[model samples]
Target chain A: MEEVLRIEDLHKSFADLAVLKGIDLAVNRGETIVILGASGSGKSTLLRCVNFMEIPSSGRIVMNGRAVGRAVDGKQTYSEKELTRLRARVGMVFQHFNLFPHMTARENVMEGPRTVLKLDPAECARRADTYLDKVGLAWKADAHPSELSGGQQQRIAIARALAMEPEVMLFDEATSALDPELVGEVLGTMKELADEGMTMLIVTHELGFAYTVADRVLFLSEGRILEQGTPAEVLTYPTQEGTKNFLRGHGSFRLPEPQLD
Target chain B: MEHVWDFSALLNNKQLLLIGLRNTLILAAVCLGLGLFFGMLVGAARYSKKPLLYWPSTVFVEVFRNTPVLVQIMWFFFAFPIISPFDIDAFSAATLGLTLNTTAFSSEIYRAGIRSIERGQWEAGKALGMSYGEQLRRVILPQAVQRMLPAFMNRAVELLKMTSLASVIAYPELMYQAKIISTIEFNPIEMYTSVALMFFAIVFPLALLVQRFELKHKAR
Candidate 1:
């Protein structure tokens, strides 16, 4: 399959400390990939760099057959306009679902299409209404973001990103801010999007969601990918001692996948 | 006791008083519009990051706010004619003084309103692909503008009351007309009382409207 996104030799260092070290990865279209990690493993940094929200110190990022951030002797650089357009292609959903306060839920979704995509108002409103309905927030079209709960807000954020019709979506712990009951609504919305063949890269601790919903899962430890395979292989039958030890400590006796008969 | 109480002269000179009322109303509206434009600039400048913008705006506000409105009138009307190298009339001078006086207070009201908005609002605006100017115009300023309105209007009413002071500059506005009539008829008590009634008629209703608007905003 053609690569929808590719990164080579990625490195991000803040001051003296390195957060991402010479990483290479490619994502195929219509794939649901989960990046699993302990806190501070640089998964969030990696996702942020993909969206160009953080500048990579050294890397080459190619999206949709275009070279985005290229390496100059293993140092990263991009033209200002190139980076702006690249970010518009890949939408990032924050952990807190940072929706605009002055706008209603529908207006929030319509903004990108009207401003960036330059769609007409009537068409944009129709698109926003469809996306909001998909996220089960049609009833909340006129409501301000503050009026919604965390999960509803996160769903609206998802719809807002989806309204842009970007090639891929990045979720940086989308459900982490929600209450336990609220988490289900957001996950269900994401599941629907995944089922509809929207390419997604999610950083999550939800092993059950990763095992059942994700096509493949990459496990990271201390800024490195520790293990990667189909969830059936990694979650059910992890080969590396580091992966096993990490899961054993955090997973307890509950195996997310069913055991062999 | 009876000297101040007679309301007969005011009834006889209703035409003069009505014309004065029209001029006062128009003058207040024009000065307020001009003042708020300068006031928004002053408020933005006061919060500007650069020292030059901040210092000049600060000095302007302090000079106008600390000095009496009467001094501002005399300076613009009498002193500025010689210092300015051009002779502007009494009405124009009064307008300039009133605008500068009201600008000082309006700027402070706006500054306080802008400061109260949540920091997260800016972050959200930026994330939604809005540039800094758009964020200020479409998001921050609208909220600030609504919050600043009651205080802005109250200060405007004060500027209107202070317009009576414009009589000292020889502007033919409401109080000036009343003074001209009093001097002609030799009825200081009756004329001054009529002037007070004219001032009260405009300011009291406006004060009540502003109070109601403020209460509605608070309830919301």
Candidate 2:
């Protein structure tokens, strides 16, 4: 498998607090990596650094064989223009969906293409329609975010990201804000994307979705990866005591039986 | 003995009052346009993190906001011309005062409006790979402007009324014209009353528009 994204010794600190300490990761093309950690364990921070939302204190990030930030005296310096371009190629979805409330679903989907790619209106509209249809919200194209349910809005947000045609998509607790019944639709849409071999980096608390969908599950603890392996390995039999304790804390989750090869 | 109320004085001064009305609109329009435009810049500056921009903006906002606007107008009229290179007339003085005042107050409105939006919106924009300008113009401002509309209308109405303050410096706005007419015709009651009514005619419609906007926003 070709490595599409590589992070070397990523570190992020906010003032006196160290959030992520020396996290090294590599993501292959078409791989879906599910990050499981308790809140404040640096899970979201890791995902954020990948897209340069939160700049790493000291590290190297290589995406699609290109360096994200310039190396100056052993520290990474990012230009706004470079980061902006990087973000276009790396899409992200948020917990609240964060759809532009002023815009309709189709317009929200059209925004990235129009602004970033400078595509013509007709082409932007076409991409919007195609992506919205893929996410199964084509009929709700004209509806504002306030007019749609949480699930429907999230699906539109997905379409908005997909319209950018990103090399890898980052989902930052995409369905965590949804009502229990609404979670399935967003996850179902994600599952469909995974089946289509879209590269994704998801930071989530949904153990069941991770168990069934992830090619590799990583358990993070206090700004470091405690354990990582196939879903059956990490979810079923974690080696580290921290990973075991973390999984035990989530007692409500029941993992599905692993498929026999 | 009952006081005789005469109505002919106002009709006699109709042309003078119309000129006053015209001046009032010119002052309000000029100030409002310049205030809103500069207000956005000042607000963005105040919102900025760099001390070079932030401290100066904070000082500008605080000085204008804390002091009475009448003092600002009088200062521009009586005090500024001593050191000012340009000619200071009634119109220029009033325009400078009101425009700066409106800029200060409206800057706060812009700041608050922008702040009221969630951080998630900004993050979402950045995640989409949009530049700061793109994010602000395309994503942040569109939502913020909607929330800011009623406040801005309120500013416009207040600004219209505030134009009367120019009368202290003898600018030929509606209130100043009314003062002159009242003195000549000895009809202070009628003159002031007519002025009030005229202001209400202009301001009441704006007030209604604000309410409609609030209702629509709430419905959304």
Candidate 3:
């Protein structure tokens, strides 16, 4: 598989607090990478840096072999226009859903295509409906975010990001805010996308979903990847004491019993 | 003997009063329209990070807001034509003064509305690959403008009331017309009362509309 994203020697700092320290990562096409970490472990920051939402203090980020995102060289640092172009290929789903409250679900989906793609009105609407249906939101085409439940709103957000036709999707704890019952619906949508062979980088706490869906899982601790490997190796039998302790604290690492009744 | 209140004299001067009312409304409309347009630009500039744009916008808002509206009217009426290349009549002077004043107030309202929007909204727009202008026009402003309607309406009503200050320059607004009639007919109570009623007729309905909108938004 071809490399879709590469991060080298990435470091991020806010004042004296160093969030990311000399991290490196490479993502291949059609691969799902799940990052598991405790709070303040820089998992979210690393995802943010991948898309230049938070500029890395020092790094080289190459997307599809093109050097992009906060380059150290004055000539290489992308302009606002260039940054917008780069960002289009990398869609990000925020934790809060962040749907435009004033617009209907369909309009929210169409916003990027209409504005960035400069698509005609009919094309925009058609694509919006198509993507909304993909996320199981075709019935909610006319409903506003304020009128939708949290899960529905998040699903609509996913549809909106997909409308941009990004080659890679970054999910920042996408299901953390969802109610437990609603979490399944969102995770199911993600699983469907994964089955379709979408390249995704996800920061999440759902150990079961990570073990089931992620091609590879990375365990991060204190701004560094403490360990990374296949889910069975890392989750089922973690080599690092930190990873083992973290997983034990979260759960027994045993799958829940299925209800037959 | 009961003293009878007579309105015949004021009614006889109906044509003059109507002209005054028409002028006031036209002036208010022109000023409000131009003020809102200019105010959006000023508000955007205030929101910008560049000191070149932000400092100048801040100075403009402070200068106009801190001073008295009547003084601004007088300065534009008297000093503007003398110092500037263009000449202006009393009506233009009044209109310009009110527009500038309204722009300053409206800009602040716009600033507040824009600022009130969460930073997460902008982050979401950026993450979707939107340009700054696109994010502002599609995402930020739509949400901000809805929040601004009540405050904007309040400022508009205040602008309408401020038009009476134009009477100082003999612009023949309702108050000016009433002053002339009161001097000529010696009927201050009836003539001024009629002018007050005319203002009430125009403003009361607008206030009610704003109240209705506020209630509806609250329900949402």
Candidate 4:
């Protein structure tokens, strides 16, 4: 499979503190990479950097062989136009759902196609319906984001991104804000996308889903990828001490065995 | 020992009052329409990141808002004709003053409405590949405009009241007509009372309608 995204020596700093340090990774077409880490581990920053939503302090992001932002005198640079074009190919689903409150679900889904793709209104409406149905939200087509439950809103958000037909999808803790019961529905929808071979880079702490669906699992610690491997190697048997500690904190990722007395 | 609250003279001059009422309404509507247009531009400028646009709009809003409206009216009516090469009648002066004053307040209201929106909405638009202009038009403004409507309506009512300030420039609006009628008829109480009632009749209903609209939006 062709490589869809590449990050080289990415670094991000705010004032005096560093958030991401010398990060390097590559995502292949149709590959699902789950970034698992504790809070402040810079997992979310890495996903944001790929789309140039948060510009990396040094190094570069190449999406489908094109540099995301410009390079001036060997220094990375960004413009509104450049970021916008990069964002078109990289769809993002936020943790908060972030649906446009004033628009209906169908309208929210149609917005990208109409505004970015400049699709005809009728075609936008048709595609919105198609994507809504794909997310099992056809019945709620006219419902506003405020009218939908958290899960439904997240599903519509996913469908909205899907309508863009992006080369890559980034999920930034997409289910973290959901009620426990609602988490499964969103996870199920995402699992379907993964099963269909959608290229995805996800920042999440849902270890169970990560174990089953992730093609590769990257455990980040203090702005660095501490450990990464297949689910069995990373989840079932973590090699690094930090990964082991994080898995132990989750408690469910350990082998099924006798309890301590 | 006895006093008669007679309104015959004012009543006899109903045509003058009607004309005044008509002129007042026309002035208010025209000024409001123009003010809202300029205010939208000023508000956009105030929110813009570029200092070139932001500073001039900021100074315009602050200067108009802090200075006296009557001073502004006289400056445009009296001093402006002297300072500039052009000329303007009392009616034009009144309209310019009222519209400029309304623009300052309306721009502030517009700024508040735009700022009240969550940043996440803008992020959502950007994440969907929208340009800044597209994001503002399709996403932010639609939501912001809903919030701005009630405030805009209230400002319209306030602008209607401020139209009376045009009387200082001898513009033939409601207050100017009332002042002339009172001076000629020597019934200041009845004439001014009538003027106050006319203002109440127009503005009270407007306030109630805006209040109702605001409540409905809050419920949503």
Candidate 5:
């Protein structure tokens, strides 16, 4: 019910080409916000810049009242170690899951608490087991990411981040890389998290899931917020030419299935 | 002329032969041990992105590997004394030379093995909130060690054979010790046969062990 994240005037560029151009946004605590946009619309970059994974050329970002991603002035810079420490409180679940191949799911989950938080072995193991169990991965705790299915790997990745006990979690196209059948399991887990009052920011194109689950749905176009409202408002009524065109562009078109010939 | 082969020569002077064998073992053990340590450091240095760090390590490997081991021996035997104002024996110089040479080659071996590991290992560690040192210790090194074991053992055998180079340095190790006894007594074949057998006794088993380990790892 309270504002947990705020972004203003976000601008990002790679060489001459601009990716994100002057975006502003806010999310309340315990709300799930799904960001929808086509490829190269700067949605992913904006998500990355929000968490300071990719530095914004210029912007303002505040997460839980701590300046999350942007160094607005010369005075607000933090060292690499300090930034890593700060990131522990605001977890980012990558699009690819990015689970460590060498470590077991349990160890991967325990690593954050053991290293960054300096939690002892017993406590780390306990929390890791708890979260892994939460994701229904208790049996697969000893398995490596390579040994798990795509959906299972993503779930473990989410559990790994959750083990850190972060205040806010960011999901960057979490289910984009999954098989069609596997997508549901990961989404189901996200729904469970959302129901538990978790503050989550998700970048996804799963329109049905977004409509059913998201507290607020944001339409990103050309690196700016084109439209944003409750899912009921934006999905059905719709507004803004960019938003309408973006939806119509996707809704009217279906991928051509390969012929058996 | 002796009427029959003198296998007893080895049995009769077994004490002196054992001492020579100890010197040989010392050369192989010390050089290879130190070589592996320094090699891992150089290997890691080579993999670093900065040209300043990688180039010097690359140059060191090239200079030692391209040049002959015998020449490296002579350089240590002759030039090491001049380079170092402090006087040390040929044995020390030879040991140091062999280690540096082995390090040059083994570092590259290790570098290849380390590089062969998938990049995903590092990404996973980073995503887990691990520091670089922790990632290396927990994830990278353990997996790399498994892959590198065969190459490391092969380097050990190479180091073992390289101990023969110490004969030129007046260390009186295995080959030199045999040469000394043969020069005194006219039985060249007997003394050299014993030395060959000793090398076989040590190295052949180790080489076999490596092969077996490699096969088992493949089966896995």
Candidate 6:
């Protein structure tokens, strides 16, 4: 498998408090890696670092074989232009839908292509329609985000990210903000994307979704990867006590039984 | 016993009032245009995190906003000329004072408007690979400007009134001409009333439009 992203000795700190402590990760193309962690375990921070949204205190983030930030005097330095270019290829969907409320769903999806890509209007519109259709909200394209339900808005946000045709997609608790019933639609859209072999790094609490969709599942505890393995290994039988306690905390939910031939 | 009201002298000098009105309009228009244009730059500078941009803008905003506009006009007319590289005529002095004053106030409006937008909107723009300028222009301002329209209109109305201050420097604005007419014609009541009516005619409609916009914004 081709490696699409690599993080080496990643560290992130906010003032004196350390959020992400010496984390390392490599994601392969067409891989869906699910990160499961308790609140404040730095799952979101890790995802944010990949896109350079939160600059890692010290780390090497190599995407598609190129280091993201330039090294100046042995310290990583990021220029706004470089970060902008980096973000163009790495799309992110936030927990809050974050759709531009002033713009219609179609225009929200069209914005990146129209403004950044500088594509012709017709092409941007066409791409918007295609992606909105992909997310099953083609009919709602003309509607503003304020008019759409949480699930529908999330779907439109997904379309907006997809319109950029990014090399990788990061979902930072995308469905966590939705109502219980609405979670299904967003998770369903994500499942379809996974099925179609999209490279994804998702920080989510949805253990059931992780069980079914993840190529690999990582359990993070206290700013470090505590355990990682196949869903059957990590979810069914977590070796580390921290992972076990974490799973036990979510004990009310049941994981699917492994298929036996 | 009531003194009889006479209008013949005032009517004869109506041409002077017309020029005054024209000067008032020109000064207001020029100040508003330059103020809004520069206000965006100063506002963005104040909003920026860099100290290089932030400090100068902070000082500029504070000095212009805290001091009285009347004093500012007087300073430019009387004091600025001593230190000023260029000549400071009455019109130039008034323009300098009023334009800077408008810039200071309107920049606060712009800053507040931009700040009111949620952080998520900026993140969303960045996530889609937009530079700071692009994000502001395309996503943030498009929304902020909607919330800011009424405030800007109010500024314009205030600016229209503020132009009358130019008359203090004897620039022959509406108020200055009215002062002359009232003194010469001995019809202070009628002349002042007419000048007030002219100002009301121009400003009232704008006030109504601002109200309409506020109501519409609330509806949305």
Q: Please give the DockQ score of every candidate, comma-separated.
A: 0.20, 0.93, 0.79, 0.85, 0.35, 0.80
Tens-digit lDDT string for candidate 1 (A1-261):
878988777888889989888778888999999998878889999888887777888877788777775657756667656665666677778888878777899988997777667788899988998999999999999999989999999999998888888888999999998899999998898888889988899998888899888988998777778889999888889988878877887767774787789
Report the Cα lDDT for residue B118, model 3: 94
TM-score, chain A, candidate 3:
0.95
Q: Write the per-residue lDDT of candidate 3 for residues B38-145, one digit (tens) a residue.
A: 999998899889999999999999999999999999999999999989998999999889999899999989999999999989998998889888899889999999
Candidate 5, residue A233: Cα displacement in angstroms equals 4.5
Candidate 4: regions farther than 4 A off: A252-261
Error of 5 at B96 (Å): 2.0
lDDT of each: 0.83, 0.94, 0.91, 0.92, 0.84, 0.94
Candidates ranked by lDDT = 2, 6, 4, 3, 5, 1
Q: How is the predicted docking of candidate 2 categorized under the CAPRI scheme?
A: high
TM-score for candidate 4, residues paired by index:
0.95
TM-score of chain A of each: 0.94, 0.96, 0.95, 0.95, 0.92, 0.96
How big is the positional error of residue B172 in model 5, measured in Å on the Cα after superposition? 2.8
Better of 1 and 6 by TM-score: 6
Could you give the DockQ of candidate 6? 0.80
Which portions of model 2 miss their true places by more than 4 Å? A252-261
Per-residue alpha-carbon lDDT of candidate 4 for residues A70-185, written as tens digits (9 for 90 to 100)? 78998888888888988988899999999998889999999999999998988888889889998999999999998899999999999999999999999999999999999999
lDDT of 6 by residue, A1-261 (tens): 899999999999999999999999899999999999999999999999999889999988999888888899887899889999999999899999999998999999999999999999999989999999999999998999999999999999999999999999999999999999999999999999999999999999999899999999999988999999899999998899998988898986665897888
Order candidates by DockQ, high to low.
Answer: 2, 4, 6, 3, 5, 1
- What is the C-alpha interface RMSD of model 4? 0.6
- List, residue by residue over A72-154, the lDDT tens digit for candidate 5: 46524546665566567777777788787778999888888987789988999899989999999999999988899999999
lDDT of 2 by residue, A157-190 (tens): 9999999999999999999999999999999999
Q: What is the TM-score of each candidate against the true structure?
A: 0.79, 0.96, 0.95, 0.95, 0.87, 0.96
Question: Model 2: chain B TM-score vs. truth?
Answer: 0.97
